[model samples]
Target: MSQLKYKRILLKLSGEALAGEGGYGIDPERVHELAQKIKRVRHLDVQVAVVIGAGNIWRGQIGMRHGMDRATADYMGMLATVINALALQDALEQIGCDTRVQTAIEMKAVAEPYIRRRAIRHLEKGRIVILAAGTGNPYFTTDTAAALRAMEIDAEVLIKATKVDAVYDLDPKVNPNARRYEHLTYLDALNMRVGVMDSTALSLCMDNDLPIVVVDLWGESSIERVVLGDDIGTLISS
Candidate 1:
């Protein structure tokens, strides 16, 4: 077996990804399949921490556009992430992987509140830690949450799993002529306004010198390939 490139990694998964092709809500089969892939990574002895988005259930920005207060909408979005995290925790455990869901907000009955030291201890003990709730505040996207968690956990890289294989000059689905980038620097992505990640998250990653790899989660073994150091997607770094 090839040596894994990353010792510890933070995986950012969108809430919609858990929905699979059905396009809404949690799909059991999809969750199980994702869990199995995660198990593969664990088998390689890599510490995994996941940060999931809540767009599938509720997007605070969208709710705000529809007349909801920004803070209230964001809180709702946080709850949505918690729901996804719990579901993923269950799935991972079903596959025999020890998992923990830590939230930014207090949810004692369901999960542990975000405690940096405790999360680190979990990773040290070989437990997959899933981070939910967007920074425990509003006006922030889960992309930012992933960056924040990656930093908190001292992860080697931020693995952003998306619907697309890589970052493109334009929406590939809408424009066939869109160019995909195999690699990029933080400034390159920022200057180009590449939508691979939010500007805030991108900037944070840049400042911390954390490399990010964006790849399609729907692709076969893409996550494992990435962890194994295969060239599979766009890599953004300083």
Candidate 2:
């Protein structure tokens, strides 16, 4: 067995990552596959916490552009995250992984309210914590929420699971010949205007010197490979 690189990791998954081939809404098989992937990580004896975004169901910026109130759009986006969280929790639990869905907004009937201590305790007890609701405030991206929670939980690294294989100089889809970055510094990602994460989240990670690994979530063993220290994707650090 390969040694685990990060004992505790916070995985940042975009809600669209849960969307399947069509790429517009929750896809059951895809979510279940993601669940099984996390199961593999847990089997590696790595504690995992996930922060899922709400782009699949609702993107506040797009809504606002369509003439919706900014705050209302953001709030709706938060609720969408909670929906994704619950779906993920169900998938994880069905696969026999002990999981908890905690939301920033109080929704006792659906999930436990996010409490820092309780979330940490869940990780300590070998359970997966799915953090939802985007920091419980408007105007904050889930990227920021993921960064904040990783810091709060003292996560060894923040693993960003995305559609792309690695970070590139341009949108690889648009530019087939884009140069890929196998390694990057937070400043490089920021100063270069690279979109590894939004500026606020990138700043937070840089401030704390937290390392980040961006991997393709669609890879068969990418999650396990990353936890086992395989050089599979772009690594942003320092």
TM-score of each: 0.97, 0.97
* Candidate 2 Cα outliers beyond 4 Å, as residue runs: none
Q: Report the poorest 10 consecutive residues by lDDT, candidate 2.
A: 15-24
lDDT of 2 at 26: 94
Model 1 pairs whose backbones collide: none
Per-residue alpha-carbon lDDT of candidate 2 for residues 1-238, written as tens digits (9 for 90 to 100): 7777899999999989788676679999989989999999998899999999988898888888889998899899999999999999999999999999999999999999999999999999999999999899998999999999999999999999999988999999999899999999998999877675898998999999988899898887998888888998899998
TM-score, cand. 2 vs. native: 0.97
Clashes of each: 0, 0
